[model samples]
Target: MRATLIPHVPETHVYPEAISVEFEREGGLLWLRFIIDDNPDFIAWPGDAPVGRADELWKHTCFEAFVTTDDGYREFNLSPSGQWASYRFDGYREGMRPADEVCVVEGLDGGRDYVALEGRIELPVEPRRLGLSAVIETVDGARTYWALAHPSDKPDFHHPDSFVLDLP
Candidate 1:
């Protein structure tokens, strides 16, 4: 399958990058790792705040990820009580439950559609490390990665006219 990076913002500021996923297993437990190159840094203003703001920020990033990828991917938040959150491509507001064992996400807007294949992944018997590459298929069947500018670099979410994705 081919992957394409669809910029969530405009073409002026964001740069597209490559994304990969690595999986590991130990004692029948599975561990998944996401490797994103040039991943934008999401900063929370004031450093700390009430739960409302925190939730808002999380939702904002989630939306950003959804739009940028056209709802083709999902993210897992590492923060406490915020684990395994899944985002879908059609729209996150549709209220899709996260996987019990894995967090799944898709783009908010209708991202390019591709068939997801099912297969078994093998890891090292003694905590072996496994890395699985994530392939994003564009509407035209091209593989690509999405990248965005850091909020601090632009400081204006109102005008996404500056964001861009560097496509491979």
Candidate 2:
């Protein structure tokens, strides 16, 4: 499945022209892709820095996925710097724990005008819904939030209504 992520607020867009996330289920793994369309000189992406599983990647430029099943949900943060993290929430912002059970592989593709992140994770159950989002930080230290759907007036990815992508 593929969907375009729109900025939470139109007036707040500083750098990115477009952002999107796509997912493909293969065997027991889910391959995810995030694309950011922007001028290289304009966006402040963390170039080819080494990244590991860390917290608060969202403080900068990062790609995110909120996967929801029947029991709970998992939040995956994938950064261009090669760092990634996953958190399991029993409910909305409840029982937060490091989802270290899933191994993730992330990398960059393409160049200046457009860059893409390819990530793969072991998904044991089919997701019921997904909230795809991104936190884009510009060279001037401005941040913009993008998501598949912005149900609230503010940028709230955790809002239950943000899970607009219903799966089959």
Candidate 3:
């Protein structure tokens, strides 16, 4: 399924005119593509780096996914720099440990008007619900949060209500 992400709040001007995610889940593997549209200028994209586990990727421009599990949920962070992070959360924001599966950043491609990253995840089971989101950092060091749904006024992707998409 594919869905467009919206900013958490109303804004007159933002560097990225739009953001979207396309994903497909089959059994335990998920393929995802994050796209930034409309002349992605002033966006601080990470340069190419070795693919490895990273911490606090959310602190910069990153694509993220929250998948539901029986006892808790899993969080996947994919960066354009080829870095990725996965964590198993016991609950809303509890028990965060490295997830069993390490997600892979397949590719990062873009041009003057757009940017995109392809990633894959091997989950223990198919996710029934997912919260797709992204943190976009600008040239001036400003950040904007984008998600399929924002349950609160602030950008809190860990909130349960943010998992608004149900896989079919």
Among these predicted structures, which one has the highest lDDT? 3
Give per-model TM-scores. Answer: 0.27, 0.89, 0.94
- CA lDDT, every model vs. true structure: 0.28, 0.80, 0.88
lDDT of 3 at 83: 96
Candidate 1 segments exceeding 4 Å error: 1-6, 15-19, 23-31, 39-82, 86-99, 102-168
Stretches off by above 4 angstroms in model 2 are 47-50, 124-126
**lDDT tens per residue, model 2, 87-148:** 88889889999985464756878786888888876553757887889898888888889998
Q: What is the lDDT of residue 24 in candidate 1?
A: 35
**Order by TM-score, highest first:** 3, 2, 1
RMSD of each: 15.2, 2.0, 1.3
Clashing pairs in 3: none
Given candidate 3, what's the lDDT at residue 153? 84
- Best candidate (score: TM-score): 3
The C-alpha local distance difference test score for the whole of candidate 1 amounts to 0.28
Location of the lowest summed lDDT over 10 successive residues in candidate 3: 121-130
Candidate 2, residue 74: lDDT: 82
